[model samples]
Target: MKEKSNRLLSLSAIGLVILFLIAARFLTTAESVRQSFWALVPPIVAITLALITKEVYSSLFLGIVTGGLLYSGYSFEGTLNHVFVDGVISVLSDRWNVGILCFLVTLGAMVQLMNRAGGSAAFGKWAGKHIRTRAGAQIATILLGCLIFIDDYFNCLTVGSVMRSVTDQHRISRAKLAYLIDATAAPVCIIAPISSWAAAVSGFVEGENGMSLFLQTIPFNFYAVFTIAMMLFLVAFRLDYGPMALHERNAVEKEDLFTTEERAGDESLERPLRQKPGEVIDMLVPILSLVLCCVVGMIYTGDFFSGESFIDAFAASNASTGLVLGSFVSLVITLAFYMLRNVLSFNQCMDCLPEGFRQMVPAILILTFAWSLKAMTDSLGAKEYVAAAVKSSATGVLSLLPFLIFLIAVGLAFATGTSWGTFGILIPIVVAVFQGTNHVMLIMSMSACMAGAVCGDHCSPISDTTIMSSAGAECVHLNHVYTQLPYVLTAAAVSALAYLLSGVLAVSGITDNPFVSLFGGLAVLGLVLLGIRGGAGTKAE
Candidate 1:
């Protein structure tokens, strides 16, 4: 009965959307629709459908079709060509996209190898002895995520791989684990000086010392800092609310990490093999090697060996290519190490190759669909429409620009599901808006852009980082999305308020200290959490 109801709802929503699109086609010219508010309709439709139906693949594909139709003026042949040849094929063939796929496959294989070697089981035993509580397990995951601040993709997979055993031992919900992995991924990378996110942000600011500007904006990064603080607070106080609270309760009380019937991955992959138990060093060595090699690979791409400094090379490096090279080397190293330990024969290791690829298939499929959706948005000039909107509204709201920019950024990033693209679009506009006028306001606005972009990426279901987090934790994709959305929105609300306060202060010329707003935001977040905790307690009683 419930399934039938859901199906009917989904169909009704689709019917309404189709009717609206038909009316829109007759109402506006294709070129005008492509360049206006209609450009955002497809993603909004996709997001709404995903949330309502709890299905990602069909939702994304429908969005692609919507985009194709809009871009090609509702011609059936044009829509087919645009969505397939121009959208999916175009993104799949991109060099960087291929590199990311290689990296995912390699990382998946590496994870399978570690599991088969009994390294993961040993680590679980080791952690159970030392970190006995659920809070401890959660905190450890956060700290590990913080340490791998090089790339969001690397952070998601690596942290998830290493910590899943410990988290499972404590009955931590995979949704919770995924949230921790994601919160630490892009947020940590954006704030870190030597990360791929910083490099992307720096590349956007053409005239300024982008690195210096990024560092200066760190204190004003309310979302990232507050998110870290919120995670710790929630853990320390044993607080959980919204869908996450339900997931956690099921996990703690019933030992059901996933309340839903869907198993996102093959549970057998995470199970200990029938071989003798391996040492913890078996897992540690390969992960550490991957990290070191990946860092080197990034720098090498940046011409570090050719005499460029470490930081400079990192800033110029191609993260996708570098990750592929690094993970591939780390795979070879893991294979040799496993052989040396006599954990498995060559045939077993070879068997894991296909097994690992199969494990990553879900993530790969979601990513490809996501990339194609973004392609459709791009073809319709979503960025241009957003940029034009921001520019047109810039004149009278000087004091409120930071807040406005933050809101705009969040909406854009959420719709498009790419923080880097959000930064690319908004950072340049912010720079142009306040390049010579107000340096203080410029810094605040830029910081808001980063914060908003991260916040949106943190929440969006179609986001690659978000998808990777689910893959890493082996959680159902919708479970991760639903569980994390409330937490993300809470943090974003506080960050938005902070941006408003900061913008007002800067415009008033009373104070330009970034910490004024930073500390203020943290205080507000603490109070909000306390209130939530109190409310939850009262309801329980």
Candidate 2:
């Protein structure tokens, strides 16, 4: 009955989208709409349909169509060509995307190899004794996620691979696990000075020490800090609300790691039951090797072997090529280790290859649609629209500038599915707006922008980090998005309020003490959660 209701609701949402498009066709000037609010319709439609319908593929496709129509003046042939030829095919044809897909498949294969060799199971057993409680398991996951701050992609998959078995053993839902992985990924990186995110952010600023500036803004990054705090609070207090609470309840009561059947019976596609005897060392060694090789590969791509500095190499490295190289090497090493240890035969190892590819098929499919939707949104000029909007709106709201920039950044990043792009477009404008004076305002605004970008990325479905987080936890993509949305919104709301306070304080010369605003945001978040839980308790009674 519930499934049927969901299907009907999804259909109704689709119907409404079609009506909206039809109405928009006759009502608006489509071709001349670039850099307008119309440019954001695609991702907005996609995100809304995804939430309402609890599906991703159709929502993204419809969004692509909507974007194509909006970009091409509602011509059917134009939309057909743009949506398919200029959008999906183009993205698929891009070398970077292909490399990322290949990397994902290769990592999938490695995960399968580990499962076939009993490495994952062995680690689970080893971890089970020490990680006896759900809170501890979640804390360990958060720690792993924070530790892998080199890249968000690496953090999501690596943390997921290592912690999946442990979380499953403790009856933690995949949705919750994905939330933890996601909450820790970009949020942690924005503050980690050595991370890819830090480098990406630093590259966006002009005429200043970007790294130094980024560090200065860290104390004011209320969203990222509050997100981490919220995770710890939710886990420690068992204060999950919304869909996540139901998921947690189901997992605790039923030992069901997945609340939905979007995946196979087990969260993993690999057959652990037919595995060979292996110790935790088998798992730890290959994973550690993968991590080391990936770091080396990243620096190698940046010419670290040529005597270049580590930080510069990391800043210059191509994540796709590095990940692919590292994962491929790790896969080869794992297979060879299994053979030498006689834990799995050559045939057995070879057999797991296709199985691993099969396991990651769901993620690949979602990523393809997501990439396509982003392409459509890009083609519709969402970035230009957002940049112009922010620039235009910055004229008179000096006191509210940080809050306004943060909100603009959130909408832009959420629409375009790129935090780097969001900050890149806005940070310069921020610099220009506060040049030669207002140093405190500039730093606070930059932090607000950074926090907003991360928050939006956290909420965006087409975001690579969000997709990878789902893959890491082996959660249904939409389920992860749904369960985590309330948490992201909570953090974002508090952060927005904090930014508002900071923006006002900057104008009043009280911006130096950002901790005051941050603590206030955290307190607000706690109070909000308590109020929500109290309401829920009343309803339960």
Candidate 3:
């Protein structure tokens, strides 16, 4: 009875919000509508509905429809055409999107091949002998995620595939696995000097050596540094709180990793140990091959063969195309290896092609919807609105610039579900502010932008990193978002406070030592975690 009432209430609320949005269309001019707050409404509605109902597909579709309706000014024909044609179709038509989709399918097939050949099961057995504790399993996942910092998408999928069996053997919740994958993905990449993320950030700076500037910002990137610290602390001290705690408790006591009825498309996450035996090399060989090939592919795309240095090639690489090229080669190699080893027949190896596509369908659908929704936001001038707002108020409160930029970046990235978009919109404005005047503050502010963009991407359900994390762990997407939110917020709060202190020091002409701010932030984070740990014990007592 309670469930039914809650459902009714949620539906009622959704209906009211939709009606309000439609009525708002009539109240505002079309020209001003896209540039106004209405540009952010659709994603807000979609995120809200997904959280409220725990149904991502319908919630996302409704959000896309809302964006279409707003874009069309409530016109029936325009709304239908815009939602499918300009939104979904347009996103799917892009070459980058196609490449990413192809990469996903190929990776999925490779994972399937490993499973069918009993490689994953063999690796699980080997891991169980070594990784005897839940903490050990999780730490291993984190380490692997960090090592694969070439790209966040690669990190998520690769880590999830590699670590799932180990974590499951130790009774770690899939949601927790997803959180670990996500925490390591973007945060690690953002700080890694040679990563695709560094390349992207470097491209945004003007009038300075972009790579050198990016290198300087790393120390002041409090969120990225502290997130890794928080993860280590949580694992070391066994401090689980909020929804994650509940999930962890169930996994330990009930041996129920899911803890909810809403498993969705996560059936693919569960592995059945194969009777046909295989070696641990089955898993490691393919994964290593994929990594090496991906690195080569990225440089190749950047014209490395034409004499560019490795770092320069990497900085100029196209991630989507490179990943597709690499994954496809790896997939073909895996098929041949499995057949040659006689662990699987040629026919059996061929069977994984379609099976792999089927497993990835859920991820593909979500990506398509997410991309389409972003299109809707873009069409409505979300970027322009955010850019204008940042530029307008940036003239005042020079000391608060980092703090203000952090907050605004968080909001924009969270709303639009694109950290890169946030970087493109805000970084130049930041560069323009302190470019020649103050290098120290410029670096500080630049770090704030990167940190805030990551924090927002870390938490936003619509983020590709978040989506791929869920897909990789085979956890329900919303479960991953909800369970991870409290932890992300905790880290973000500490990061925000750190930025405030750093900004003040930079403005007052004091010593601009990043270690001072970084250590101070770490101290604050340590205290907060200790408090939470103590409180959890008291509650138990």
Which prediction has the highest TM-score against the true structure? Answer: 1
The lDDT per prediction is 0.90, 0.84, 0.87
| Model with the higher lDDT, candidate 2 or 3 | 3
In model 2, residue pairs whose N, Cα or C atoms come closer than 3 Å (at least 3 residues apart or on different chains), thus clashing, are none
Query: How far does residue 249 in candidate 2 sit from its true spot (Å)?
Result: 0.8
Q: How do the residues 197-309 of candidate 1 rate in per-residue lDDT, one tens digit apiece?
A: 88889999989999889999999898999999999988877898998888888888899999998988897877656456778998899899999999998888889999999
Ranking by lDDT: 1, 3, 2
Q: Residue 103's C-alpha lDDT in candidate 1?
A: 97
What's the distance in Å from true for residue 485, model 1? 0.8
Off by over 4 Å in 3: 264-275, 537-541
Could you tell me the lDDT of residue 539 within candidate 3? Answer: 17
lDDT by residue (tens digit), candidate 3, 75-138: 8999999999999999999998999999999998898888888788889999999998887898
Estimate, for each residue in 1-541, the C-alpha lDDT of model 2 and write its tens digit: 9999988998999999999988998888766677778888888998899889877878877888889999888888988999989988998999878888888888877888788777898999999999988888999999888898888888888899889989988888899899999999999999988777777777888898887888899999999999999988777666778888888887888877677867732444556644346689879888988888888888888789998899878777787888888888888888898788887889988887887778777778778887888788777777777777788888788889888888888887887677887887889888888867878888888998999999999989878889889988888888898889989998998998998887787677765689989899889988887787677621110
lDDT of 2: 0.84
**Model 1: colliding residue pairs:** none
Q: Lowest summed-lDDT stretch of 10 residues in model 3? A: 264-273
Winner by lDDT: 1
Question: TM-score for all predictions?
Answer: 0.98, 0.94, 0.97
- Candidate with the larger TM-score of 1 and 3: 1
